[model samples]
Target: MTELLDQVDWQGKLYSNGWRDASGGVLDSTEPATGAVLGQVGQADAADVAAATARAAEAQPSWAEQTGPARAALIRRAAAILSDNRAEFERWLVREGGAVPGKAAFEVELVLGELWEAAALPTQPWGHLLPTSEPGRESIARRVPLGVVGVISPWNFPQILSVRAIAPALALGNAVVLKPDAQTAISGGALVARLFEAAGLPDGLLHVLPGDAEPGAALAADPSVAMIAFTGSTAVGREVGAVAGRTLKRVSLELGGNNALIVLDDADLEVASSAGAWGAFLHQGQVCMTAGRHIVLESIADEYLERLAKRAANLPVGDPHTEQVALGPLINERQLANVDRIVTETVAAGAEIRAGGNYERLFYQPTVLAGVTTTMPAFREEIFGPVAPVVVVRDEAEAVRVANDTEYGLVAAIQTGSVDRGLDLARGLRTGIVHVNDQTLNNDAYAPFGGTGASGNGSRFGSQSSWDEFTQWQWVTSRKEAHGFPF
Candidate 1:
């Protein structure tokens, strides 16, 4: 067991009846890299969902009753604890999620920063002082937590993705019923309970019910939950959104992406090549916002593609635990197969493999496919793997068109020597986040981050923006005397 998990207060209290289903069936949590039984993780069914929601609904009012300042204080304390134990948390992230150690540390550190930023929401919720009709009549708008928030996070960045959204929800004085991605249920659930206790969060304020779609859908469909926040595929996001919609509850979705990277004619060859490689291959390209499609202007398309192909081929691939590893394995065999299918299909469709398309023990070599057209399935879909498909474009206008051709608008990046040109191209891209001279996955704690179109419905881990997602604004007004109302 890792040091972080060993410190857990799991005296059969925080997690009980380990790895059992709602019907009391045991399921093993499989390690993605090796397909070994990591441990048993509890699986919640509809009944478990109901129970968790009931608990959350019951605790909601008292939690909401706490002043925002009080909640903020608790969040600040949590931030402190995260900073104090960053190493342990990062290690746990690597062991459980198969993230490269450096990337894991970066995400954990970002989570702590997010905690502190969310803590400041109490004193700085950007509500409005509405204009009043008459003098001596005062009107103001105040934001309040959406009681009983349902947070469903993905496994990609388990600790950061799960906690970042939950922190803001709790800091804004809401009770949370979280269902992390089943693959990372144990780590995510354990961290949530432990961090809350370490940070002094009120008992029963946060609950983790790890399970499958049955439980999650039930939770979202429940009328008791005021809001639902989810991070996953667009297909599932639509299903969850429909359920939440029917109940008239607030919903925030961070879905999948087939993000694009545009390398303009004026772009520095070296910089663009490096950025493109990282954007496409980082996280083994498992990130929703990974730049799967590389759009290079025709002027230097050949040279750019050649340089990127070399860089992709050279990235060190090995076990995540090894310090020499620059790229780790895909999350599971399913992901490996998914990438494999795309690679094989692209090749069959006449696209040439420029660098790599081989796999060994879950580790996939960084691949770059040349002469890929928009009609190819790899170009049309979210290839969440270490595969970069290069498409040549005539000019900036064509680059823009090709980048926006996809159904996914989660994130997009443009590289150009001219800042003005980059900004101009960026403004035209439909992605939720557009970057100039950098990749869209460049994370900042305070920025409103998420996606658009099929990519996502709203933001997360974005300081006050996340608070807004988890909170509701109420209009509070006082008058000198009761005014006569005409009904």
Candidate 2:
């Protein structure tokens, strides 16, 4: 793992144009579970962002002019390099991002899929023809790259979020300036730089800056950047969107979610319990699609709660790098404190902690909360932790009402014996993504992934959605003879 760091030159240097020292100095990337210093990461400031964006602006045109097959070959090479270093990347994810081994492996798999999907973008048909009303005229509409794209990614699932934007933007002939969260800079930003560098990507086409909010804000407001792809909390996303909106730059925001998993009366308790546990507890419930609210039918609420509590109580929590645990530590102390506060306050507001409401250091026990109401913080807010708040509803109508009550409309799930009933309830719930007879934690590289309302703008990231997110339509017309103007 240390060798991987050395290979990538992860010793206090940013990848702006090329590997160089950042003016803002270096910060230590530490393991959250044990507070061990993994390596030093260069911190980029406003000036670095400007320099990177300017360089990206200069490089984009020629890169765009490259033959589609030529650009695609490089993207495929990057994916190959990522595959070769899969084990090292997984270790880094476990250490820097505090992800469990399984979660780390899953993230890597998703990233590889994203890379492969992006590689196909260059060769896809990007334009269409339309009939013209006038004689000797031809009209066409084509999708063109948005020049330079600025990517701001979060620590949770850092690599996937960053690559989902970066891979597509680069493959679609747009240069990128990426600002990864300081906490998981290596896994998110620097490592990406190394992969592209190893794959023989052109210098100045991609820049990796690992830093605090200053560089991120500068990147968002940079005039040379044509678009901003942001993924984080709703609060931060709003700020980024506002800044980008002022400049009239396109922005893609994949923000927070207070998602739900509905378990109907006919749901198989055993199967639903397993799915619910995985949905809420995977990655210590740090996912945006985490099933924070479990709305159950009143008839089987008791049995469902019992089953959920048992699963929460038995799941192991510890350092993922050294232990065989089901759940890993939260990203840092701030996240852990936030999770604890929500759980404590919700309990005080009359919710019952049915099982496992405790923590030592950053490893929080998977908690099951019963008798939770919509007014409680755990039920209303996006609790990014392994805490499941179960709410009882009289019927499917009440379940849909409770699910749609929140400001977030990111994702939802319905578990029932009848697929038709589950699908019917899914239609009534107001969310961008829904899973019938499944849990809320779902994503695919070949499928559109995003949310509505506070969760995000209407932008999505994946498959054909990537084409829409990274490019804009330009209409072109040609004629054998020029038409006279109606003066």
Candidate that would win on lDDT: 2
TM-score of 2: 0.98
What is the per-residue lDDT of model 1 for residues 317-404, given as tens digits with 9 covering 90 to 100? 8877655787887888888898999999999998998899898978899999999999997899898899999999888888889999
Candidate with maximal TM-score: 2
Candidate 2 lDDT by residue in tens digits, 103-124: 9999999999999999999999
Off by over 4 Å in 1: 1-4, 8-26, 125-127, 134-137, 458-461, 483-487
Candidate 2: list runs displaced more than 4 Å. 1-4
276 Cα displacement, candidate 2 (Å): 0.8
Question: Backbone clashes in each candidate structure, one number apiece?
Answer: 1, 0
